[model samples]
Target: MPATGRENHTAPKAVYIHIPFCTNKCFYCDFNSYVLKDQPVMDYLRALDREMELTVRETPPGEIKTIFVGGGTPTVLNPQEMEFFLNSVKKNFPNWAEDIEFTMEANPGTTDRDKLAVMKAGGVNRVSFGVQAFQNELLSGIGRIHNTDDVYRSLENARNAGLDNLSIDLMFGLPNQTVEMLDYSVSKALELGLTHYSIYSLKVEENTLFHTLFQKNQLPLPSEEDELKMYQLLMDRMQAAGYKQYEISNFAKPGFESRHNMTYWRNEDYYGLGAGAHGYVNRRRHMNIKGVNPYVEAAMQKLPRLEQFSVPEAEAMEDFVMVGLRMLDGIRSADFAAQFGVSLEETFGRELHKMLSSGLLEEHEDRGGYRLTGKGVVFGNEVFAEFIGVLT
Candidate 1:
């Protein structure tokens, strides 16, 4: 109850539940998800329940401050199924914080009045709608079945259900995406009175449709210069709309920053439930089996399809630096020392000094630490790689 640390440390305050069923897979999405035409929805839920039970029995989490049910479109579940899934969550993790920030990811097409009500009743305080873009043409191009109307209707449903903590996701740098189109998407998302927004540039990941198109010389993504302009335009627009850029790709109204995601950025541990879910706790990281059938079978046998590895001290120290730097506030030196029982300089002195000299990172005067500069953010992978060498 006090928390988990040496003297006054606190236990992990976050939870992530993966719902892997979706109506259909998007062309650009490679997340662990499957199409749900005639899939055994109830059976999967039962397996998820078992998985949750087994997880809690192994390592019971403390009072949770945040719970994020992300997915393959969590709203794909029917009202009854949604209720069952959420209730199972409560039953499995009974001791949640009083002001728990419970968020659920909903696809615009699948969310309806009934589903919204069920989610609200199930303790989902925030709903993040995947609204990719405003234009119907772009939506279809991205293999999204929902039209603009579905976005409007879904927001209305959530508002009518008294769920006002809403966030909308948008994308830029898509094939054939223009600055004008990006503006329209941002304007439409603002018109919905969303409290948060997550806008990301498209990355052609391997095995995705976009990758295939790129290999075939058919991908029509924006030029690098245009993509840079789009990023600047979004930052300017969101700032004008009074949204705070809390993390790289996330903006929020005052007090609405994503608490669950902050857990990861802050390098804190949390439990990840369901297939393909990953977790970090007690200096160890693990991942659940990715395939649905394999996950279900493993859980039924009281064996999580999990692979655990102990994070070495040096790696953990560098991890603190890498993940904590993702936040705008940057890392705190004293906190890092307290957590690791070693000074920051003693661990990453050479890499930190080198990066600081290169203008890739700057020292945080208030926190006695370092954070990525604007230049570094553009080339963060390079900056992070330095820490890996330090670990070696």
Candidate 2:
């Protein structure tokens, strides 16, 4: 028996590749991406190839079910760079599932006909564009190089290249953004008639420009009331338009749900390749080196891993409950027992009872285990916080 890219061969069923290069840094972004200026571009690509080769040889993937290329912007890669990167991916983990969902995160202006064509030919079946807002001012405020026109142009280019399993990202709670602005963005997104929509609220994370602005009372973010209204309106509009809120932030048509993302929400193992990428396999988790030069130098011998640790069972169970609870369908009792060889009730009964009593968690009549109720969704952080290290 060999690894079929599943549990059979002790290999992860999913893979995540990181390309940490961007055209320019977004004010709201704090990801591990560097500016694409005077950097060793080809050296990084070759280093990624080296990392992939070393990784798959050691772990020897089974049959990869999903592969996601995420980054500062994977589309920032030129046609040649895109081809080279995808080639390394295929060479290292060749055995793929029949319906492997390959996705790449792209920016609007960076993606052109040639690069998209290269991507489609390189086994990327899905393209998720980062089109946060349709208004030009909003786009400029965020330091995003792409405009509304570029969004239209990029989508047209992606479609013309024969890639229609597409999705676009939207944001709410932006600086100087209004409820009407979110409504306009949603209208434009629905007008595109795409497959999926990932509408996320803006969180002012530390070390980001937005965070600094907030500390100085200069970031003109939407009022908390307005932000919440924006979220509620988005849910209503997407539901009216026939998209399912599959995850907290994601909405998709019936069959067009992001399989690659679901792989993470389901708490499955995945191979993480490239600099600053993270992977969880065989109950151990590790992140690659963040610096480009260090990762490249280290991959010549072994993976440029920054941290690695085996997950304890208690911690693993806590993770399962936290991540699994984010979906619309929620976690199941049967699935819990299958994974942990113990009943869900046996571990989180006290916690479940507490949430249920507070109307934050509800037992699904049809599917069994608990799910977040409508109120629970609003107070998700409160609910999730209770699960961490609960078993301990």
Candidate 3:
């Protein structure tokens, strides 16, 4: 079998770089990103390079297995800037594994042929297009500047640039979204025959336009029953079409599961670079400074860390359960013991007994692990909550 992952990590094998520039902010997005019209793009890139230099000097990475460049639309960079940035990444993370899954998040409208070419030459083998909806009006209402036309154009450009590992994002439970509308959108997505698909429910986050509208009863959202129906329909359709539900919201073909995302769910260590990025290493978690100039200036002198804290043992235990349960295969008791040095039953026997008796969890058939039952998936929050604060 190919090397899946190591049980213990001495250094980060996965890396995440954040690009915080976007042409426009989506109404439902609350991520740490900025609109790019008047931002200091070049200076930020230089500072990013400096930060990576300092970080690698302190704690160099192993052969990088995964590198995910997420953004406020990483494809917003021009060809020249993209080339410079990718070169800096190569310089810092010098050693890469044989099967490095280098992914760059792109907005559908931002990636032209030239930009796609730069990304391919820079070692980016996978591209995830943020095509939230296929409907033009819904796209406009959600504050995305791209339409269905740009989605096709961007994918064509990516393919032309020699990239076939492509994925697209879709959102359900959106404003004015009916079950029928979601059905139509899913049908359009499945027709494309992409390797991976991520369908997420919209959450009204604070400081977003959607939140303001929702407060004033201006945002028209699907009813609770309708949203549930959309979720069920999507699960059924994806499974029928032979896409595996590898995670709660992700579906992919065999061997095409997102290695970078699995790193997070498996609680692996990774390096985080750029403004407002978060990372966990050496049993501590850190978030970088959020403001653009502040991060740039700080990176010049030192690492641009705004907050860092050592995770206590009990809290780490809770995090293991919360993060691991997101995977449908669930957490293995032996793997848990290998990481935390305690048996799963000994640590959470009370909680496990309760969850098992209530039919929220059951022993996974092929492995000695516990996974969510069908009812548990719907009420997953309740199950996760039971594990939290139980040990800590």
Ranking by TM-score: 3, 2, 1
State how far residue 357 of model 1 sits from its true place (Å): 2.7
lDDT tens digits by residue: candidate 2, 1-392: 22222233367889999999999999999889989888788899998988888888788888898899998898888999889888888988899899989999999989999999999999999999999999999999999999999999999999999999999999999999999999999999999999999999998888888899999999998888998899999999999999999888999999998887877787788899888998988778999999888988898888889999987778878888899899888899877776777778988989989999999999987998889888888788899999987876
Writing each residue's lDDT as its tens digit, candidate 1 over 1-392 gives: 32223345345678898989898888899899999888778888889999888877777778989999998988999999999999999998888888999999989999889888988888999999899999999999988999999988889889999999999999999999998889888888887768899998888888788888899999889889988889888988998999988777889999999999999987888888888998877777889998887888788778465697877777777788888887767788888877877778877888889999999899989878888887776667788788874665
How many residue pairs clash (N, CA or C atoms closer than 3 angstroms) in each of the candidate models, in the order given?
2, 5, 0
Those runs of model 2 whose alpha carbons end farther than 4 Å from true positions after fitting are 1-9
Highest lDDT among the candidates is held by which one? Answer: 3
| Candidate 1 TM-score to native | 0.95
> Which order, best to worst by lDDT?
3, 2, 1
Q: Which of candidates 1 and 2 reaches a greater lDDT?
A: 2
Off by over 4 Å in 3: 1-9
Each candidate: what lDDT? 0.86, 0.89, 0.91
Model 3 TM-score on a 0 to 1 scale: 0.97
Candidate 1, RMSD to the unseen true structure:
2.5
